[model samples]
Target: MSDLKKEAESLHKAATALRKVSHHTIKPLHEFKAESDDLGALGKLGSLLGATEDIREGMHTLAKLTKQLDEEWQAEAKLMGDVSDAFDLLDILLAAAAQAKKG
Candidate 1:
């Protein structure tokens, strides 16, 4: 196989690995909560409901903020990658020019 093909395959594997890690690291951007341990014989029903609702709202807000921050970071990363690619393309162009001059 050609070197470019090998490099592409390696890049694909690396990207897949990174994508899996990225997916796992983000955890599902959904509201999650700790179940009510206090809902047992320890508290009034109304108080328990109120507490549960409070926890739900708090988790919802937290998840929303977490998603926004994740999106912002992802956007910044994409921009940086674009800049890097632009620089790499310059090297490619220069190499092509040198080859043309040799020909």
Candidate 2:
């Protein structure tokens, strides 16, 4: 159980790190979007057009990865909550059993 807890802690730490990095990655994409908007007029010249497409693709990929990461974190949190609830239920059962034995 201790080992499982340790592993869960490690996973939580790694997920936290990924979340921070994901935010950092999205920040640059926001800046890129702003620049793309500012250069929308220049996109007609065909030079910035390809760059815009590449940035769009990159942003899409990053957004997808961020969503997946978020889902994974949510699932992990729910699993942990369920485990805690199970332990609480077990404690309650044990207490009731002890009281029955005393009575």
Q: Write model 2 residue lDDT over 25-46, tens digit each, in one string.
A: 5676567655654555555564
The candidate maximizing lDDT is: 2
TM-scores for all candidates: the values are 0.49, 0.51
Q: Per-residue lDDT for 1-103 in model 1, tens only?
A: 4344445455445444544544654645531322222333335764756775565567667766766776665665555555545555655676788899999
What are the runs in model 2 whose C-alpha is more than 4 Å off?
1-49
Model 2 reaches what TM-score against the true structure?
Answer: 0.51
Candidate 1 stretches greater than 4 Å from native: 1-22, 25-28, 31-49, 94-103
Per-model CA lDDT versus the true structure: 0.55, 0.61
* Model 2, backbone clash pairs (residues 3+ apart or across chains), number: 0
Candidate 2 at 69: error in angstroms?
A: 0.9
